[model samples]
Target chain A: MCQLLGMNANKPASLHFSLAGFMCRGGRTGEHSDGWGAAYFEGHACHLLVESRPSANSPLARWLHEQPLRSRNIIAHVRKATRGAVALENCHPFVRELWGRQWAFAHNGHLKDFDLPLRGRFTPVGSTDSEHAFCYLLEALFRRFGHTPPPTPALFEALAGLACEISGFGSFNFLLSNGDGLFAHCSTQLHTLQRRYPFARARRIDDGVTIDLGRHNHLDDRMVLAATAPLTEDEDWTALRPGELKYFRGGQDLPDGVPVAAPLLLAV
Target chain B: MCQLLGMNANKPASLHFSLAGFMCRGGRTGEHSDGWGAAYFEGHACHLLVESRPSANSPLARWLHEQPLRSRNIIAHVRKATRGAVALENCHPFVRELWGRQWAFAHNGHLKDFDLPLRGRFTPVGSTDSEHAFCYLLEALFRRFGHTPPPTPALFEALAGLACEISGFGSFNFLLSNGDGLFAHCSTQLHTLQRRYPFARARRIDDGVTIDLGRHNHLDDRMVLAATAPLTEDEDWTALRPGELKYFRGGQDLPDGVPVAAPLLLAV
Candidate 1:
């Protein structure tokens, strides 16, 4: 199994603080230490850093954990290599381009014999079940929508339906994003923390580090975090139910222009 | 226009030395300075760093310029936007995946009113004509050869032909690599320097920096570098003729197993 960490903030924010604790899970605290990867989106482009090395001891990972790179949306994964070899290509999160937008995906569970046929358009560069699934999803989405990008509600519906179908194979917990919005689905495990106004002090679950989130804000803007395991202990973390799919944008569960009674409500 | 620098080495080698001189063109020594980007391929995965800010002043670019990350194939570009807005997506060294391999391309020239229709699968995440041309090239290649990757010689023929057609539109000097081989096509301006045994001291053209290449060598392996402009003052830089398309792999002008009399000879 692998670990996933994501951040969606209203303003451009750094992930170094949380990344420090997340890197510990790669080898120091837990055992998802085969390889690690992270993608930082700056508008439409993504800065990808992937290495086939344990994060706890890798100098590159340490530099990233200490770097102050900020992004509106970020996704990271530390792999234990359930399927593919411990190579750089097999690291997550995997990226693909669809509808002129870069989409990224990372999974934490295995899909038993998930042999889905793929079109020549979107194929996997890495020999991993997760990459195969990501390509399949994008292939299906492109096939359904053709050239134009689908409306957000329509896209959410299509993705949720596809997630439900894939969940039948096995555990399919995953986090995905396309710069504008993030989509997370759970089959067995996934947890999230929503940080808004009147932020509270948070304590790390892996290490004994604590930080006060209230002192660094002046706006009502919020940030949402998703991870396969809880990174903090003091804050309230909400775990996604089995077969549940959620879409978040600009740190809001339902961002602007989406109806509250939209079809995405069916996901939860 | 943009400036491109690509390195194809037998062993994993660092680009920091060449990058130091190349980055100077982004803002200091010359004025390609709208934005800059570079992609380093480690195994089948590509580590891409792109930014809208000028490479000379951006902290991230400075860090990358100073880092010791090494790879067999590296492609870097410093862009002066000719067709697109100054944004992250508009930076050069665009990347796409084909035949289960990551392929990166960086252009140094412009195409006048060049817009080709995309087949949805490998659409451009950015609005630059360079990216549009990249998608078009990949779409055409996929259509020509369905699922399997074409051989190096066959791919060289197809790309040279396509490049000849695109060059008719405007200047189209570019560098492309698929982790296995590096291809550079000169529509107007491109130069290459091959470094082998008995290396001599090399002097930087941007800065009066000199380094003894012999001090770092023991084996007889070689590295071939291609760039838009000459990087060193003391070495002989061979300029590729207009309409020439050359290929290199493992630091060789012609890799093993290819008949020297193949159609690629037309490129010479």
Candidate 2:
């Protein structure tokens, strides 16, 4: 299994603190060391960096940690290479253009016997089940809402149905973002944490480093983070139940009040 | 107008020396100070870096100059913001996926009245005539070839016809690469140089920095470089004619021997 990390912020925020602890899972504290990738979204543009080297030792990853490249949405992955070769193309998080915006996806769990027929609308350059699933999800969205993206509630519902259907193959824990919103689905394991105005001090779970979140954040700052495992020891990290899908936008989870029907083509 | 630089090598060779001179044009030596981008292709994977900052003074561009990341195909651009805002999304060397391969394109000139109808296949994420032209080119290719990519000679012919058709709108000098080959189309200004055995010393035209190519390259190494202007002072750079299209694979230009007709949809 790979490890995934995602962040959504009301304002452009840096992932420096979270990445310090999360990247340790790539080699230092965990076994997910095959490859690593990170995508930072600034408006409709995404700055993506991926490497076949271990994140713990990669110079580029270290550079990323040092540079405070702020973004509204970010997704990262540390791969263990369960489904694909340990090459640069197979590194997550994978990026593609959809609906005139750059979309990024990263998977934490493996999928078994996933033989969904691709309609050539979105094709995977890598031979990973994760990429195949991402392509399928994007293709479904494109087919349903050709060119015009649906509203947030409808998109969330469509993604939820698609995630449920894909989870039937095997484990499908994944995080996806298209700059405007972040959607995380849990098939087996996923955790989420929200940071608001009244922030507190926290300690890194991987290392013993401690930090005061209040010092780095403003009064209006709000952010949501999702990872395969909790990165901080003191922060309140909520574990999502299996087969649950969570939607976050502007640094807060949307209240589960919007009603929408299942997707039209879940039978596929 | 912006500046474009591309390199196609028989081996994965570093662009350190060429970039040193090319980046100087971003701000220090020339007037293209809006933004800059570079795409380095390693196999089917592309490591893309773009910043809404001048390449001459940007920290990321400086780091790129310091690092010797080698690639068989590389494309770089320094933007002057002829038709778009100075944002990350509007930076040159725009990338998209086509035929299970990442395709990168960088344009140096501006287009006038380019209002082509998009087919919702490959949409431009940024508001730039260059990106619009790139999307149109890719959409045309996809419409012609469907899921399978055509042979090099056939692709070259298609691209040549498309280049000619697009140039009818305005100046359309560009560099395009899909890892396997580099295609250069010259509407007004473009130069090409090839370095092979018997390498000699060269001086940067921008900053007068000197380097002995023989010291860093093997005898069997070969590379073809395309730029808006000759990067080196002592190299025999040939100026391409207007409306000329050149294709380079494995560091050498494909001789004009493959007989192929113009694309059928050039009338469109």
Candidate 3:
């Protein structure tokens, strides 16, 4: 198993604080040392950084320590190489273009026998079940909606249905973003926390470091963070229910009231 | 106009030597201060680093100077923002996946009214004539030859014919790679140089620094470099012909004997 981290903020926010603790899990605090990757959405573009080396010891990771890439949405993952070779192509988050926007996806858990029909519209560059599932998900969406998406709620409903069908295969915790906001699904382990006007001091779960969020955040700086495991110990982190889909935009949760489509028998 | 630099090597080689000088053109040596980007191919994966800020002054560029990401094929570009906005989306080399392989592309010149209708399979994330042209090129090829490409020579022929058509719109000098090798099409300004067994001392044209390449490379190490301008003053850089398409693999040319298909009236 791997790990996933996501951030959605009303105002563009820096992720160094959370990323510091999160990267430690790549090698220092945990054994997920196969690789590490991240994607930060800035305007219509997603800047992706993926390394096959362990993040805790990578030079790029060190530079990221100093430079704060402010963004409204971000997704990150540390890999343990459950279903693919330990290579850069297998590193998440994987970026693809759909509807003229760069979409990035990252998976934390395995999907057994996820051999989906690609149909040539989308294909996996890496030999990972996660990438294969991702491509399949995109192909399904494109087939249904063509280029532009349907109304927001309709699209959400379709994604939830797709998630439900895939989760049946195995643990399916994943994070996705298309420069607008973040979409996350949990089949096994996931946690989420909100940071807002009333901030609190937090302790890093990995390194035991502490910081006062109140000093670093503005009054309007509302944000949501979701991860496979909570990065901080002091903050209140909510455990996402199994087989749940979550949507976040501009720091607030978009309630998952959209009903999943009739159980999909669509399997490869 | 922008600037392009590409490397195809027999052995996986470090790019610091060429990149150190190439990056200077983003602000120091030349005036391409709009943006800059680079792509390094590792096996079937391409690690891309792009920034909206000038490469000569970007924090990421400074960090890259200290680390060596060696690869067999590489492409870099420094933009002067002739058409699109100065943003991350407009930064090249732009990457898209086809046939489950990541293809990276970058251009050095502008095209007037280079609007091409996209058929939805591929689209540009940015509003640049360069990217639009790129998407059109890919669409044409995919339309003719689905996901899997024809033979190598046949693919090269199609690409050369496409290049001839697009170059009619502007000075379309570009470098494209799909991890295996590099394809270069030069309309106005481009140069090529080969570094092999009898390497000699070289001085950087941008930074005025000198290095003895003979000492740094192995006896069998071979590389071919293509750029919009000669990076070093001492090297024997050959200026590409007014209209030329060159293919390079493992540091050697594949000899352009492939015949171009007759021009078609497929204007978008």
Alpha-carbon TM-score of each model against the true structure: 0.94, 0.95, 0.95
> After best superposition, candidate 1 residue A13: deviation in angstroms?
2.4
How high is each candidate's interface RMSD, in Å? 1.4, 0.8, 0.8
Between prediction 1 and prediction 2, the one with superior DockQ is: 1
Compared with the true structure, the alpha-carbon lDDT of candidate 2 equals: 0.91
lDDT of 2 at A56: 87
| Predictions: Cα RMSD each | 4.7, 6.9, 7.7
Task: For candidate 3, give the lDDT of residue B233.
Answer: 83
Per-residue lDDT tens digits for candidate 2, residues A95-189, read: 99987899999998878999999989888888999999999999999888888989888888889889999999999999999898789999999
Q: For candidate 2, write residues B1-268 as lDDT tens digits.
A: 9999999999999988988899999999999999999999977979999988889998788777778699999999999988878998999899999988999999988889999889889888889999999999999999888889887878888998899999989999999998887999999999999998899799999989899999999999999999999999999999999999998878988854153454688664
lDDT (10s digit) by residue, model 3, range A1-268: 8999999999999989999999998999988999999998877888899999899998898888788789999999998988889999999999999888899999988888877678998878989989999999999999999888676677788899999989888999999998788898989999999999799999999999999999999988999999999999899999999988888888978886343455779789
Show where candidate 2 strays beyond 4 Å.
A256-268, B256-268
| Models sorted by TM-score, best on top | 2, 3, 1
- With candidate 3 superimposed using the best TM-score fit, by how many Å does residue B115's alpha carbon deviate from the native? 2.1
Worst-scoring 10-residue span by lDDT in model 2 chain A:
A254-263
Clashing pairs in 3: none
Candidate 3 on B95-203: residue-level lDDT in tens?
Answer: 9988888999999998987766889888889989998888899889888899787777888889999999998888999999999989998999999999998998999
Off by over 4 Å in 1: A255-257, A261-268, B255-268
The reply for model 3, stretches above 4 Å from the true place, is: A257-268, B257-268
